[model samples]
Target: MATHSSEINGPDVNDPAINGPAINGPAIEVDRLTVRRGGRTVLDGIGFSCPPGSITGLLGPSGSGKTTLIRALVGVQIITDGTVTMLGMPAGSAALRSRVGYVTQSPSVYSDLSVAENVRYFAAVFGLGTAEADRAIDDVGLSTAARQVTGSLSGGQRSRVSLACALVARPEVLILDEPTVGQDPLLREDLWDRFHTEAAGGTTVIVSSHVMDEANRCDRLLLLREGTIIADGTPADILSRAGTDSMDEAFLSLIRHSMAGGRSTDEVTS
Candidate 1:
């Protein structure tokens, strides 16, 4: 992780384009977000912002509310307190629905369908046309596999297909939960390159992942522990705060500090 105290800019935290959100606009903003499962609190006062044109990775251990947070962002989970705003509107709302694209942990595509068929299905579901859907498939380097049976594809290949399906609608906010889970390191690297390319092209991307190295590739990160934000900032900011050279070391140091004190990082955002 890298650290810099200077304020970072892009879209607000929720917008997919975190680097240059709507030419001086916040893409996503959350304030005092909290979520509970049944009666158990899963997230407590969680808050973070992502501007457009940048990539923000949601990192944490298993059951740390990473999925819960992503679900809240994409409208699958409701906030018990606080608010989640995307593109200046509430997430999961009808207005944000057209502008927000999401790929869940499961491949949401039909295994029996062809790659192109899956893209077309999503296009129809998203109200996008063939031309745009085709372009999106090409964007993710899945053009060659368009005619193949999706179930026959390899894991990495399926991941790419899922990504392409998500992009078919050209949504401003793209939320991905464990997008690269099954991919090997090499393919994962390639996916990150594609992610960067998408971000540079002005897409706001929020991804959830347990892969530390993949998290390092993000422009900014929100680290979660026990369903709460333990650290939030650019990688460098976290690294500096942890007083370590590598992000892994920084994360370990921060975890140790938290265990010693029985607390998350002291920093809290409104």
Candidate 2:
């Protein structure tokens, strides 16, 4: 069995001090979250909180439950136990339908439609106007290709279209799963910049990726292995605690320590 460490600054959803005033509580909170698929536990007692206006990176290899966790947060996955609250309401509530934006790993767009058309469609679905949809298309650097047919665009361009649709709603919480998978280095950098811009504007951005290099771009990181979070904290904090200079090294150090049956580096440091 894999052991997990408690979050250092766990937010209290009920306490006004944590949830009141300036709204000091987290934008998303998961408590003892567990998920099962096909009779096997995919996520085991996971817990964490993503603060408002922050960029949280979920880092884990394939089948590490990164996708599953993201689905749970978006209120799509059925969990066997635990709870997920987003913006003070239960995950997947009807009210959250417009306040939360989700972009899956695979691009979900109409191949026959123009890039701009796709964004416009989703924007309307979210009750947003045409201007919002146009801005979102530009935000993803797809303005020049907005009139191009989605099927004629490259894989990277198609992916950006999906991202634009998600951004069109301008949701308070944005969840992206492997969004940069097929993007070029320049496109990836631009997308990261956009993510930070959104966070600066008070949007909580939770992104999931298997790439360790992207960890440094996040305000905080949650490192998972086999559904268990082994490290959770700022990138610099994780490196300092793990005695590593890089995110990859930090992950390896934590993995080695866990394999040795020792306390998680995060726990020891906390």
Candidate 3:
């Protein structure tokens, strides 16, 4: 766990967050959600809710069910049991088709289309204009590549184009799967800032990433392992729960504690 600590980000104790969101209901709610893949359980009756106007980080090691959990949230994965509701409707409700934005691991853009064309098409699909399309491209740091074809771009650039397409919609709920997997430090920092800005504007943003350092940037976190939740709470809450001030040390302690047969639900609640 300590060696893997290099992959995650830390928290800021002095960072202040706003209060009193206009909408008080949970943006997403999962009740006893379960998923099984390849004759093995991927998510074992896991449940949690993400509040509106907040950034919730879904983090864990490889194969810890992070991708599958996020897939369920976007209504693209089949579940054996449980219910997922977004904005007071079922997970895959028709009403949410335009209200929820999902960015998968693979870039979902037309390879032949230029960045601006790709984003503008999505924007138009959502009844938006060129301003919104341009804003989304800038938000993802792809302004210079606006006229470049996506297929000729590098993998990272293509990923940014996909993100731009999603951002152009400005959906009420945004679900991202490792949005910054191979991005450089400067771009990663810029993208995280964009996420914070989106959350501040009342969008429920859920991001899945392998970077531990980014965990600190989230308002709350859901730590998972082997299809079960190990810990769930704010960064400060998680540190206090693990009896440590360092994020890396705290995760090591919590993982050890969970492996020692004491993964109680009480430890997951705020």
Each prediction's RMSD over C-alphas, in Å, is: 4.9, 7.2, 6.8
Candidate 3 lDDT over residue span 26-119, tens digit each:
8899999999988999999898998787899988888999999988998888989999999888888888988899998888899999999999
Worst 10 contiguous positions by lDDT, candidate 1? 1-10
Segments of candidate 3 deviating more than 4 angstroms: 1-24
Question: What lDDT is obtained when candidate 2 is compared to the true structure?
Answer: 0.87
Candidate 2 residue-wise lDDT, 163-247, digit = tens: 9999998888999999999899999999999998887667889999988899999988888878888788888888898887988
C-alpha lDDT of candidate 3 relative to the true structure: 0.86
Provide the TM-score for each candidate, comma-separated: 0.87, 0.89, 0.88
On a 0 to 100 scale, what is the lDDT of residue 63 in model 2? 88
Q: What are the per-residue Cα lDDT tens digits for candidate 1 across 48-120? A: 7787777999888898888889889987797799999888778888877778888888787888999999898
lDDT (Cα atoms) of all candidates against the true structure: 0.81, 0.87, 0.86
Error of 1 at 15 (Å): 16
Order of the predicted models by TM-score, top scorer first: 2, 3, 1
Clash count in backbone of candidate 1: 33
lDDT score at residue 221, model 3, on the 0-100 scale: 94
